[model samples]
Target: MTIQLKQEIDKVYEEDYLLWLEQTAEQLRQKDIENLDWEHLIDEIEDLGKAQKNAVETYLRQLLKHLLLYQYWTQEKDYCADGWAEEIDNFRNELEILLRSKTLYNYSASILEATYQKARRSAFKKTKLDIFPSECPYTLEQVLDLDYLPE
Candidate 1:
């Protein structure tokens, strides 16, 4: 069921994903570190709830990768770009630390799971009624056939 939901969600936002990657990559090439506002980013992330929030966080991680790469490129004094390699490594480690310590996606998984479960149950109930062809509107089976699997 999760697989089907993931597929549907991907289908719904396919364009957004592509655009986000392109923009992030462009920001990297332009060395637009000043425009990579983390506070606004965090606010945008916070506005999302459940699976959408998780998805956004995953996207943000990709953006962070590009940002770190850009940081490395910009930190080069003579284009030698030596010390920045280590700095990039440290930056990635720091991101990991922040993600772990800050509970960035802590609420997202549970909220999404609960919402998904509710929707799945509602869908399954509707399908079961359709399959049985019962005259009574609310005659649910003791054991559902489980036809409305996620994927």
Candidate 2:
């Protein structure tokens, strides 16, 4: 098939993304470059990478927020404290899986400070206690550690 055939189903990207994806892959596998939807295919591939990186940053941000709250919000500790710890654990586990890919690993590591900064601001807002440090207190390794808790 020619790229003309791919263009015939151009609307499929918005109407039936799965079919568009399948057709795109078929074009690649069959070496039908002439029929390939170059622009949308490149966009989808780039978006997929961005989505993965966003997930990593989101989980890392949550983990950092909960850890900061658990450690620094000294006055508000109560029945919910354990829940915060559990969230930290959950985020760490999710990140562990997401970070297994080398690209994602580096992506996550690179954004640690930005994620921590965002989380820290949110943590401060949640706790309303200005006692936390100006910078991230936990290292990425420490944040991911199941055993580590701030003293």
Candidate 3:
């Protein structure tokens, strides 16, 4: 709690980040609240939450893109459908892991519409096709269903 101790922790945070993380964990585990690096710890925690939400958004966008391509890009479907399906499965699996947290699941649902718009644009850009719908075609339930694929 002394000025010198705070300065030492700050120096470690700047010069040796891994060491600072270890020290921070130890301090937290021991409930040494006085010695905690409050500012940096708060920043790191916020960043972690953002990272999780960002990851879910990314995966959902990718899944939607591939789904669009696979279902509607008939010209290339024969050649690329299998690869697209595989990518969809991969993204879905990644999403499943992240969405296990109820907070993150809700976060994903909250962003679904905006994320769909982004994915729609990406699909159009990639295929240079005008067939994709202006609104999202898949519901969250359908999108998350492992057994579901558009006919």
lDDT to native, each model: 0.39, 0.85, 0.92
Across 48-121, the per-residue lDDT of candidate 3 in tens digits comes to: 99999899999999999999999999999899989998998999999999999999999888888899899999
Query: What's the lDDT for candidate 3?
Result: 0.92
Give every collision pair in model 3: none
Once fitted onto the true fold, the runs of candidate 3 whose alpha carbons sit more than 4 angstroms away are none
Q: What tens digits encode model 2's per-residue C-alpha lDDT throughout 1-151?
A: 5566656767788799999899989989999888778889889889999999999999998999988888877776676688888898899889889888989988877898988889988888887877778888878789878788776
Model 1: worst 10 consecutive residues (lDDT sum):
142-151
Query: Candidates' TM-scores?
Result: 0.20, 0.90, 0.95
lDDT of 2 at 89: 86
Q: Which of the numbered candidates is closest to the native, going by highest lDDT?
A: 3
Q: Which candidate gets the maximum TM-score versus the true structure?
A: 3
For candidate 2, the per-residue lDDT at 6 reads 59
Task: Please give the TM-score that candidate 1 achieves against the real structure.
Answer: 0.20
